[model samples]
Target: MTRFQSPFVRVCWYLSLAILAVPFVFPFLWMLSGAVKSQTEIFAPTLTLLPETWHWENYAEVFSYQPFARQYFNSLYIACVVTAGTLFISSLAGYALARIRFAGSGLLLLLLISALMMPEEVTIIPNFFLMKWLGLMNTHMPLILLPMFGSQGVMATFLMRQYFTALPPELEEAARMDGLSRFGIFWKVALPLSRPALAAVGIITFLFSWNLFLEPLVFLSDIELFTLPLALSNFTDAYGLPLWHLQMAATSLAVVPILVVYIAAQRQIVESFALSGVKG
Candidate 1:
């Protein structure tokens, strides 16, 4: 009789897989559990995989607790705008850097690299003063403008440049032969083939905007103008203590849809990032 793989090896492999998955999977599981669980149940030592007493009211309460719907829309539209702007700005800059032969191209790349390596906190103070001087203080303008021109945009631009640099010159030459301008070839042919890079930029930018805390915290005070992350943190009592139930529910609201999309397109989504040079 032909030998078959042992149950022992299969069990060991499955166990190993489960162990590896815990770090990624556990936080989500906790969020979901915390969303539905009561204040008391959330802190239980054993941990509740399922809600012991499901408090479905938390979902409604999440909205009732603040201007959550408005905040949700704030984060949503900001993310969309930021993502689109980054993709447009990054891709164009990237193509130019990759294809054009201008003086100081290397120096420009160096400056961009420097900006990318520098942490946002290091610049936030000066940026705050700058925003104040420009009359952009306590507005969405800082959130939008800072990121659009900041290291994030630079990173996206570099990613696109790298991707563009890898494309064949023959295509551009063929486009020229076919009476297409450089802009036309770059816009039509190159961009059409660069959908993966675009998707990567869009997704990363969206997540960045969605999860942004420090900028919103420092710049915003109006309840009506708060983004989701800032709004979620605002669910505290008069003593500056947290209201965990509402916070978790709000967090679940903000994060779950993103998680859903990520799971649904895990392969294509992941490949896009990996292709764009952000391996994780």
Candidate 2:
């Protein structure tokens, strides 16, 4: 029988899903509700989903308190650059590792795989020094370069490599028979068929760069260079006490765009993963 034919089972499955989703869904709901609440209402002894009175001015104050617009732009642009760079570098490396039968190619793939086991915290000190030595501290260069060359990029490369390895050899053989060079086959044939993997990589890389906090915290001190995560932490009074209302408002604004994009492209994201999984 079809799943829909069993009403009791379907109800139980959906009910279980709803129960599991509460923890994840409620926090966002509370954040949205809290954004419009006054400081008094936010920390009130009694909890309510909607505030007693909505304080809309909290959003206006968020922008005035810091170089928020500039910081927002910094994050948006940095994430875009990092995503594009990761896609190009990872796809090229992945394709080569998967398709080319060169000396030490297996060893190179093994080394790259080993990198995934190393945590970012272990490399932070060396990376910081490297950035400073290169005069990249307090600049967007480290932010851009680190994610493109770091563990996240390695993960993307492996993902693409898996996807590429699963592709049928006949396609490349056909292209080769047509007298296409290796680069031409990769550029014109393979890459064109790699849209799903590319989308998966781009989405993941973009989100990683967008939500990156530790790298920005260590490399950047200038407010103008701050990404969203760093900027969100700056919502505080002179006494270093958090301006909770303003912070919530700013966070809501920052989160909404990503939420919108995710909601809109969720189907594509799922499809990409499915395609990658099937191929891999």
Candidate 3:
């Protein structure tokens, strides 16, 4: 008779959740199954979930077809660097915007918000020109600098600012009384307590940079400079037909690490959003 033991309610809830999860979960399942399947089996009429023969060599072919291992390294390192840089810069900017009352602070924050409304596509050409002018064309510097200073980073800054603004003023006031300078307080007190916001920002920024395709496509021409997304696309035949087997294998490799990391830190990621919501 208890609500927890209501069979009708439980069934409906479980069924609804299962239905909702299908779209999100099915694509990954398909991707995984496709990764190990032969090209023929992949496009076959039967639409099987498991491969008839698991092409384990598809993985090896992923490496041999191009500088895929190198490409993997490129994506991983770029994502890591972008994540770290975004965290530092956003946290600093966020803390200042949340606490400081200097003239033009409002205008600066407004400008940053306006920057968010501008799509990346609109500015890609200008960005390309800027990068070319700065001698950063065909380099990882554009990848690192663009995302670290673009809408994503600005969004991270706003998230941190909201979290910091919600924090108790007494905490920083006490630190100030103890002769803690602004930088010292930010480094020692504010940053330590802003873990949830930082975690959320880092996770999102890393994933964004990892899956970025267009920026890399435009900025990099060297095969060795290609990231995972670009490298995955390089698996094609002489006639420009996609080599699905190898492409799927490389795609799976590119996605698996990020999937593992997200699953591992899923709890923290959820908590980060909850914390941000409370602050907002």
Give the number of the best model, judged by lDDT.
3
Candidate 1 Cα lDDT to native: 0.85
Candidate 3, clashing residue pairs?
none
> Model 3, 192: alpha-carbon shift in Å?
0.6
Which clashing pairs does model 2 show? none
Alpha carbon lDDT of residue 254, candidate 3? 88
TM-score of each: 0.91, 0.94, 0.95
- Prediction 3 TM-score vs. true: 0.95
Candidate 3 lDDT tens digits, 38-103: 988999999789888999999998888888889999999999999999999999999999998899
**lDDT tens readout by residue for model 1, 32-108:** 77888888787788856898889989999888878899989988888889988999999999899888889999999
lDDT of 3: 0.90
In model 2, what lDDT does residue 113 have? 87
**Candidate 2 at residue 42, lDDT?**
88
- Deviating ranges (above 4 Å) for candidate 3: 2-5, 271-280
Q: Highest TM-score: give the candidate number.
A: 3
